[model samples]
Target: MMTNPTKMERRRALQDSLNDRINFIKSVEEIFNCHMVNFITGNLWDKHIPEPIKEEVAQLGEEKVLELIYHFGSCNSKLEVKMELTAPCPTLSKYLIACRQYYYDMTDPSINDEESIRSEILNDSSTSVSDADDNIKKRNLSSQYLTPAKKRHEVDVMSSFIAKMYEKKLANQGIIGAIVDIGGGKGYLGSALALRYGLRVLGIDVASDVTDAAKSRNDKICRKLSEKCSFYQQKTVFVTPNTDLGNLVKEFQFLWGSVTRVALVGLHTCGNLGASNIELFAATKTTDVPVTILCNVGCCYNLLDEKYLPEGVIDKAHYCLPPLLHGHSVDLPLDETSGFPMSDFLCQRQFWLGRNARNLASQSVERVMSQKKVAVDALFHRAVLQTVLLDYAENCSDTVQKKLLSKLDEMMVVGKGVGRVYKRNASLNLHEYLKTAFEKLDLDIQLPVEEVDKLSERYDCFKSKIKIFYLIRIFLAPVIESIILLDRLLYLLEKGINEAYLVRLFDPLISPRCFALVALK
Candidate 1:
């Protein structure tokens, strides 16, 4: 029988695995940049599409490309390559194989293995609570709120895990104290922790409106439980940017009454706020008030400050690491003020991914694949509209062209909002929608019916090319997403915080941005 690895050995193994994956992503940064540049700048319907992509599409033919897209969409995993091809297009088949392999290779094994990580953390040990306590928690959960079922599941799992971590710290450090909820809008999770665990909670947020809402929510909960919990409207930005860490902790201690231990938590803390929480937790250890644990689940990657980027990525144009390393980077030495080289190993190279790419990273592959038909229809609408606008602009005056472009922008926004309606309403005509969009613009000039017909014909001719471009973009999605999640994980690890873990906390189908970065000291 094989011996199980020690905790230290497992940690080293996980780190090594992450480093190897990071290196792999770095190697392919140029290729990803090339693909993104073509997608961003090249016209899909024209000869402006990248030469390599055009050649592959030509080799596969329109029928084959469509077949492959449909086939890939229905399957759960890329490993399901046994589906027989409609046409013997060796070039396209090879390319499809490569795309699947690239996706699986880039994905971190740890993300899908949430159970294993939880097991490792809990050491396969179960904590016993009285029947009364369990019943109270269940009652509070059912009575408490308007959150979706999936969100409730996430909060339940996360809160229980955090409570356990807090108990473990209490046993070790001989300090039992409050849980601090960062960006605690409406105080859902914080209130739950207070009711279920009997732990004092402090919920903080910058938005006064939301903070007010949270206070109202707490009032309702307190009425139900016959107990009060602390919730505050504090500006973390002010605390992080202008104040001294030691002084801030002292201030919190004074207000909260000798808070010697704290468990910092946030659910989907956006952008730099998540990073700020990590910094605050680390800083607390330096002060008399020590933060024993932290559990932060971050979202909105596009909003993260550029300064927090791995040092190597700061200057590069196509800076975003591939999906595998998305939010995490390899360990790099830290600078006290700037948190430079967020990943230690990433200091050797530079890369950049734009806001569009980061937003793309938040998408769920499973959901996208399942909803492929709807997604493709939306893309088709956009592509056809683009062609129509271009043709209309060709014969028009500069003033007319500018007006047409403005109308096109409005139509794009409307299309996104009503995509499902368009899909379901078979009577809704695309040509009619375009005409209505133009009419709504209330331009002085009118587009003739003949012109609309001509534009529709042109779109039909270029439809195949647009579909192929969409497929290629979809294929690259997972790769981009992986890099972002990994980068976030690396940021914590690079700071010498070893207990950090990246977990898929919610169902991706229900919540696309479901990954959570969990840590404890």
Candidate 2:
């Protein structure tokens, strides 16, 4: 039987394959820009959609598109949805099927299944000499621990995987060490590692309140372990790539005695922090100790710094990388310190996905399909509210228009709250609800009850167009998300870090931003 490739080998393979297809990335960006640019700009209301795409969608027939959406959207199961994408459409059938398949290909079942979890965890990295013994130990320990309250099953699995990886690193590298949890909110994963694996942990966060909470939580966990396990908290910014992590540890005097290696781990580190951790681990080189392992799961792509992109690509208008990278040459020099494609190569050819597109990328198709009606209703209501705001603005003076539109921005929040309440109580009167919500907003310009009723009545006419637009946006979500994830993966590979691996580490249905970027030296 052919054995699976090691993590480094896999990273190199992915990098080489993707890098060779620089033109393919450009083509993907063009397709998204052509089909999804308008959808990315704002809500799926009538005016937000581009005229050409709107005409094409209209020609495909709204009834057919709506039919296809409801047929695929109301699927009893994910498998059924994948199988049922056979409905014919003039333009959208191919795109709809592609979206469904993308979701299937990305879903990682082993993260949630108990029987396969251990093998999955062990397979994530290159096999060490003590693999068999480590697997057996992890299997025994998996049953002994209780998953913390309100924590997803995927997180439990991730903590166990990271803990096991830490052990493997310790044994293989022969370094007595401590685990540093960057952005360790509430110290849930850190405490678990300390209690279950008996590894000393230093949970770091920017918020003093969160650090204090993590300390209190760790105290309880240490008590339960019946052994004095050190779980320290430091409130400071630690994600900067140039920050001297070795000196920071020295200042805190954490795990000062006989500590020669550190395992840097972050469970769903937000925004640029994940990328920064990767850079920090690669750049930090101390004579006495070193960061041997780095594991990070990142979310919120919209928050990433545009400065991290190749030079001369940082457009002040947009805060996203793709917009800056689009239509540019892919050949740029790599950063010496981090190996990131600073300017040259495929990094120059990077595609632009707007903030809304990035946000949409994190949504789960399975969850959306399961809650199809609710999702549809929510979109329908949002579109209607947008229409109401537009109408209200059209009727008002310049000053009133500005004031009313500012307050109408709150309509999204109100709509979301109302949608949730409406789902539980189907008999809930929406018109009355809207009136109450709008009244509470206390806009200087009066939107009388009758005017609100008129807007609510227009929902029936707008529902079909809104539903079709929503479905199109949903169909393009995965494609846009794939580019964002690949960029990060490529950034690591460009940095010459061969051990970096991008693994689907959570169930997207429960946690949409579930991919973990792991590296070890």
Candidate 3:
């Protein structure tokens, strides 16, 4: 009555199944649009992507572009909402759906009758078993992801999927002895993995407040998730007060000298701190003990090496902009800690507009008194001074003081691109204004204006180089992933590990936000 499928026929059927899966993914992506598509596709990563990774990478990049757009691409601050992968691969999707179904089945009250229960179990259990059987069949059909390959192929793919891509990346083979998280605020990322994956985690931060907060959070999480992270409270240590990064590394090594497999994971490590971790890994090398992995999610690249060059950090006195901005080495007499506050930077450019308005108004008597270092309650009189600067002749009680501030404000330039910002009808060419300012400043100096211009040009050129460095750090994650693959190959050649595999499993919901680093030996 029925004919069995031939080998060739079976192969064709499998190919058709794969086509269906691919089409399903593509259709979902299209439906979700770019941003949502990126979030969802991240769960479908493979080590050797038969298809290009560029499409997903570009989609993920849109998340950053969205942030740039929200603040009108302001020089300071970024959009705060985090992008997450909501849908992963079909397997994960099914798992999630099944879990939800199970939860609902347990909690939801359904019409219960003896006959209905018996019928449902008899029919539904068989259907579920058939569905499970179909899932096993589909696994083979999805050859691109589940194709029979060497163990190494699977591991490489899995590793690429689970781990966040980073630069100067580290690969771990055997047991991870200790994980030191640098600038690991709250140790959320590191602690999570340590608890889940079973490792000792040390959270290193300069701020005692941050470390203490992380400890509290860790304790709270441990209390709630005692079953899952029972060892987390015991294994995790918070280290602070010693912000000196180099000294911290030395101390860490001294404490755990016997640890062979060490990993350093940092989420949003700021400024030059991220780069310092790389240097520590490269500089501190041993034949017996090796730093296995260094994972960093770096933010605020503008705060990197103060000098305009790669070698800037070596010289203590040389002050440069954080990796992201103009690096000027003619020290501003400000220490490493002195710079624009994150609060100020993260505020919208509108805050600068308020400052500009204040600058444009004429200075008040109170302002003059404050400038002369007189003890005036400048805050209380600021409102009165504002009205006087606008030339509103309101005979307020503080008219005399307001008049003085208005005059002073008239002398001061607004929108000079320094302290406060003012919006111009048309975009102001800040570079041109800077050139003019430089020329004017040279008028009083013995140095010729032409010489000053030459110096400015040199500084600009150096700043460009610094920008390149920042860009590299900004995109370090992907670059690191690539490097770690090469490291794995090298490790294979050296016989440090054997019969191992790696793979990158991407989530489909959050634009493949993370990879599942599968290690199978």
Alpha-carbon shift of residue 223 in model 2 (angstroms)? 3.5
Tell me how far the alpha carbon of residue 74 in candidate 1 is from the true structure, in angstroms, after superposition. Answer: 6.0
lDDT score at residue 343, model 2, on the 0-100 scale: 24
User: lDDT tens digits, residues 333-433, model 2?
Assistant: 32333322222234565534433444566555556666654345555554454455455666768787666544443332121122233445454344544
- Candidate 2 error regions (>4 Å): 1-87, 100-152, 231-235, 250-256, 284-287, 307-347, 405-430, 444-450
Candidate 3 accuracy as TM-score: 0.31
Q: Give candidate 1's TM-score.
A: 0.72
TM-score of each: 0.72, 0.72, 0.31
lDDT of 1 by residue, 314-430 (tens): 323332222432332222333344322244444445434543445455555567566755344445554555444455555678688666554443333122212233435454455
Displacement of the residue 378 alpha carbon in candidate 3, Å: 26
> On a 0 to 100 scale, what is the lDDT of residue 415 in model 3?
16
lDDT of 1: 0.55
Of candidate 1, the 10-residue stretch with the lowest lDDT total is: 127-136
Model 3 over residues 1-521: C-alpha lDDT tens digits?
Answer: 43544434433443333233334333322211111011111211221122322243234453443332222211111223223432212222232232223212221112111122222222332231112221111111112321234322332232222232111122233442556666766655545544434444567676778878777776766566553443232222333322333333344554444444555555445544544554444333333545555444333433432222223222122111124322322212223531111111112221111111111111122122123222111211221222222232222235553443333323221211122122344332323433343243221113355654554454333232222212212222222222222222222222332212222222212212122211211
The lDDT of each candidate is 0.55, 0.54, 0.31
Off by more than 4 A, model 1: 1-41, 45-78, 83-116, 122-139, 171-174, 224-227, 230-257, 282-285, 305-341, 388-427, 436-445
Model 3 root mean square deviation, Cα atoms: 23.6
